[model samples]
Target: MSACSVFDRIFMAGLVEMNLSFASKYGAKALGR
Candidate 1:
């Protein structure tokens, strides 16, 4: 793979991970169970 594509994928993956982690944290807090 090219360097540019590799970087793009890594960046996208990081963003996805951050989003999922944020959502999961809030969901858990909302339950309060």
Candidate 2:
């Protein structure tokens, strides 16, 4: 595997984690309404 591929994988994983956290936060706010 190349360095670029490794970097891409890490970037994607970070995005996924960010999305999950954001979604959970939004969901909690919606439920609170």
Per-residue lDDT for 1-33 in model 1, tens only? 899999999999999999999999998999984
Displacement of residue 24 (Cα, Å) in model 2 is 0.4
Q: C-alpha displacement of 15 in model 2, angstroms? A: 0.2
Candidate 1 similarity to native, TM-score: 0.72
How displaced is residue 20 in candidate 1, in Å?
Answer: 1.0
Prediction 1 global C-alpha lDDT: 0.95
| Candidate 1 local lDDT, residue 22 | 93
Regions of candidate 2 where Cα sits further than 4 Å from its true position: none
Identify the leading candidate in terms of TM-score: 2
Instruction: Estimate the Cα RMSD of every predicted model relative to the unseen true structure.
Output: 1.2, 1.3
TM-score per candidate, chains pooled: 0.72, 0.90
